[model samples]
Target: MSVAAVLEKDYFTDYSILLDPYEYFDAMRAIGPVCEMPATGALLVTGFKEAVEVLRNNVDFSSINSTVGAGVPLPFEPNGSDISEQLEQHRDFYVGGDLVVTFDDGRHRALRSIANKLFTPSRLKQNQEYIHQLAKTMVQQAVMQGGCDLVNDIATPFVTLVIADLLGVPAEDREKFREVIDNAPPPGNLDQSDAPTENSPLVFMGTYFFQYLMDRKSSPKADVLTELAQATYPDGSEADLLDMVKLATFMFGAGQDTSAKLLSNAMKYIVDIPGLQAQLRADPKLIGNFLEEVLRLEGSTKATTRVARKDTQIGERKVSAGTRVLVALAAANRDPMRWPKPNTFILNRPKIAEHVAFGRGVHTCVGAPLARTEVRIILEHFLAATREIGLCESNHGSANARKFNYEASFIIRGLSELFITLAAN
Candidate 1:
């Protein structure tokens, strides 16, 4: 397709693209590895090798200035390509705004250090038993009900509670926060609105965590909040109070929704594939690979935006300085050159681990370990707790209810609602 033709197609606002995107991805990739949409001043990258080149080379493509405020470019771009200056400029636009994903300065490394300390491999492994028990409890509740909306009753609530535990929220406040978390809309849900503000979900999180962090600072306790409050940079400087608040708030909003979507996507396939649950129950070892296949097939994030710091080339396409680049991770994950039968979901695919579902390079999802552990435990517990899982005809209002609605956003991809019936084992 021509540049003008691609520009005419609104990748960000079109709702239909959310429901089905592989065709669009294939078409864009067919044009070239990198196709510049003149209207948006962005290049859509759908090739695997091209994406890795951009993601790993942060100097050429600066994520810092790409999404300065509310994800769009600021009025005045930072003068030079200094990572610190870019971050400082971003912070000026949005106060209390030093997100680990967007910030590319000393503070970014410091926040990342804190995250590594908090969610280590051993730490996540230790939490597995607790997560399994929690999943089992939720599954038992759903099994008793005969049928339930898997997205709401199981995946959504499970992720919220897990995040609450991870954040070290007091037991008293968790129940109240569960309601707040469940009702909050996930990313892409607000894309339809014009200049969508933080809305209810963000406002609730920002207000609640602000006070929570203050309490943690004044009265230290044995929890994640206390740890965050006392975290320091490599230079031994204490983390700023506002930065901590922003990190905490961002974690809840960004972390919960993605984990829930991962779970929901995996379940949709398991219930659709005949005897898959039974096979999984017989051999629990396959659970890990199964989860990998699901992630590869349906990653929660479809595309993330970046901008060229200086003129660069992705494949043969020449990208100019300050040009926005949309890295389509989902499309890259399905690159035919990288994987044979790229569209199929094969649990035992040898190269499954190579997929970029959690993204690549510096901006990879920090909550990845937690997300994996959460989904693995849920699947393990669900298989052990249920004899059979099937779609609920009454809930869908038809016997042939294969079609489903998805989140209406170009960025995040997930089912809006998933109703299922389960028989107890």
Candidate 2:
């Protein structure tokens, strides 16, 4: 059956779907592997196989079409090879826009290849220790407060600190970095907004990042930025400073946003489910499988946009050139065809590790290792420090009460506020 005939309703713009998307996603998936959204004129691929096909076939489903300045109309066309010009256009459209998630050109490939090296095993190991230390400190501080919003008090700050470390912000200036982030609205808050205004927090972040890049270039310190400044593309050419700055800026903000969401979602499951918290506390080794299950059930990303470079068939749906496709990773992870009893969070599911939480193929998130390390370290510390963790009935009422709220976002799945109390062992 044609996707249009199989699906009749518009799913993309329906805000109600964000409240509880799994059921609706399941319904959509049942229609077929691919369904067309008439509202946005985009095809939504829900099946695991079809989603992987689109992600892997980057040549056919090009990501370059969905640049940083997508959707909103702009005076200056965003198509250009000039890195500076691209940044200027992106700035005018939306601040803190980076090429890492956008550009799929050769330059992007080169940048990704170079950036992937930064997360080497040694660096990741070092960061893991640091994250454990930081998590212990955060958990201790939260315990002292008796009860705290885990999203704000723990996951948010923990992810931000890790981002600061990765960005090579100085030890003395780390607090300043936190201050900047705290002052700004949460990332992805304005993703669904009509257009980015001049005074958005994104703009503030972009401005600060530009200056930070300049500072790093001038001082040539022993940080990631310093390394980026002196690095070269895969070719024998020096990487553009603006390119490096933009990549760094994107990674800093986007990394924190997604990692915090992933960690928050994982913590929510740990606290919400019965016996799960105690089980993890008893055998912390289960934390890895627990996280993998969380990624499979409630991944950080809901979907990603791609544009068809040429007329192609995604599953049975024939997508024309220039057609926008939204690959639903969350739905794909839960696809019954790929996962047996997909809804159930089996801690030791043999194939759980194959879930595309960080995506697949060349465009896979480079920060996955860092995010995993952050989540693992934080959970280890949280479980070790606390004998029991429970939702704060005072702050969030009871689990059955209408006290908790997830962020109403199209792309991310995480709690806006998760108030929990950790009893120190």
TM-score of each: 0.90, 0.87
lDDT of 2 by residue, 343-402 (tens): 997888997888888889888888888888789888888888888888888777778874
Predicted structure 2, TM vs. truth = 0.87
- Model 1 lDDT vs. the true structure? 0.75
lDDT of 1 at 115: 74
Write model 1 residue lDDT over 1-425, tens digit each, in one string. 44445456667665656677777787777777777654455678899999888888776776653322123544466454433445455455542234566666455677877777877787787777779889989988988988788887788778888888878776687667667756655444446433322345556677778888889889987667888888887788888887777778777767777899899898888888878888899998999899888888898888776767676778878776666788888999888988789898787999788888888887788898899889988888888888998887655555455778787666677888899888987
The C-alpha stretches of model 1 lying farther than 4 A from their native spots are: 1-7, 65-74, 77-97, 175-185, 189-200, 394-401
Worst 10 residues of 1 by lDDT: 65-74
Q: Best by lDDT, which number? A: 1
